[model samples]
Target: MHTIFGAGGAVADQLLPILLHSQQKVRLVSRTAKAIPGVESVAADATNYTQTLQAIKGSSVVYLLLGLPYDIRIWRAQWPVIMTNVINACKETGARLIFFDNVYMYGKVNGWMTEETAFNPCSKKGEVRAAIANQLLQEIKAGNLQAMIARCADFYGPIGFKTSVPNLLVIQNLIKGKKAQWLGSADQPHSITYVPDAARALYLLANKPEAFGQTWHLPTASELITGRQFAKEAAAVMQKPDGVSAIPGWMLSLIGLFNRPLKELKEMNYQSDSPYLFSSDKFNKAFGFTPTSYSDGIKETCLWAMESGK
Candidate 1:
């Protein structure tokens, strides 16, 4: 049985169908009950030890895909507690764990980031991410738990329309026949992970016993493109006139004064302020998997935006 602890998240939502297609008995656990046909649903807040343990009971494998609110205070206060609760619960239940993570802990990298990159977090949020990730890594090193960290680069996909930066600023704008906005520098190349590929690679990693007790970067397209190039390609796919406006870091910071989300985004501007090249060659070679090309991914994303009216 496979249980997803933070069910209803973008990644967990994408992963559910894949697990079901493979004939796995699934349980969804979250703060609120989400009723999915034929799947067991448990309402539990992960920050509470008893609730977390009860929600994870009887699971053969557990996927920690929690996405907390994007606020520094919230992250700093809740992240560690949630990680501790989940780790202890999984340890007691003897369930193999898979943690879905992001690249924030690496901070600003001068080159392409591989699994071997050391944690040197820059932002308050990055520090919080680094701490929780290390909490899990220490257990792996001590051989106290069976687990692995599956990390991904900045993601863009059809489902996470609201939270995805590219979707909110670029794709959705292009779909609406308005000039798209690019955050940070438009010339700096950035690597983005496609949502479907992330889900597929995550499932593959969980099934492989050898993948446990280590960190693996999920499969992402090898090609790196600048924000300007991405907007151009997306415009071409949508057959819309190409035009994009770039949002500098200072401007984002200035706007953050009035908007809470933008204020939270101020610290993460480093990601788009310069090149963010991510390498997944380790997972690609290990699983013999390839990621979806940006051209195709953009086309599909554009189609989804049009169809869903998002």
Candidate 2:
């Protein structure tokens, strides 16, 4: 049986269908329960050790896909506690673990990022991510738990309503017939992970014993495109003629004075200020799967956004 924490989130949403279709017995755990055909939904707070233990009992694999509030305070206080509970539960239950991770822990990378990159975190959130990731690695190194970390670049997809960057700014603006707004420099190249591709890659990694005890970057399109290019392509897919507008850092700082989330984004603006690339060569070589092209991904996402608004 496979149990997925944070089952209602975007990644989990994409992962569910694939797991069910494969005839796997699945349990979906979240703070609130929702009914899904062929799957069991359990209400459990993963931060609570007892609840998490109950949720993982009898499971063969546990996928940690939890998403906490995007606040430094919340992350600093809760991430470690949640990770500890999950690790202990997995250790006791004898379930293999697969953690869905992000590129934040890498901080500012000068070139393409691979699994071999050193963890030099530049921001507070990055520091927290680094610490949590290291904790997982330590458990694996000790032979206490079998685990793999599947990392991805910034994500955007059909179900990305609550995601940052593309959904909140670009797709939302396009749906309203307004120019897409990009943070920092729009001309710098950046890589984006398609959500369904990420979900599939994570599932694939879980089944491969050789993938354990290491980190794998999820499959991403080979082409690196600028934020401007991304927005223009999205507009073309949406059949909108209006172009994208690059929001200067000074303007974002001014707006951040009253907006807490925007204020928090100030520290990570370095990602957009320059080229950011995350390579998935290791995963591609091992799994032999191709990621969705950006053009196809943008078209599907825009269509979903438009239909979802209706």
Candidate 1 residue-wise lDDT, 89-172, digit = tens: 889989999999999999999999999999999999999999999999999999989999999998898875766888888898
Instruction: Compute the lDDT for candidate 1.
Output: 0.90
Error (Å) of candidate 1 at residue 131 is: 0.7
Candidate 2 lDDT score at position 217: 94
How close to the true structure is residue 42 of candidate 2, measured as C-alpha lDDT? 95
What are the clashing pairs of model 1?
A: none
**TM-score of the candidate numbered 2?**
0.97
For model 2, what is the C-alpha lDDT against the true structure?
0.90
TM-score of each: 0.98, 0.97
Candidate 2: stretches off by over 4 Å: none
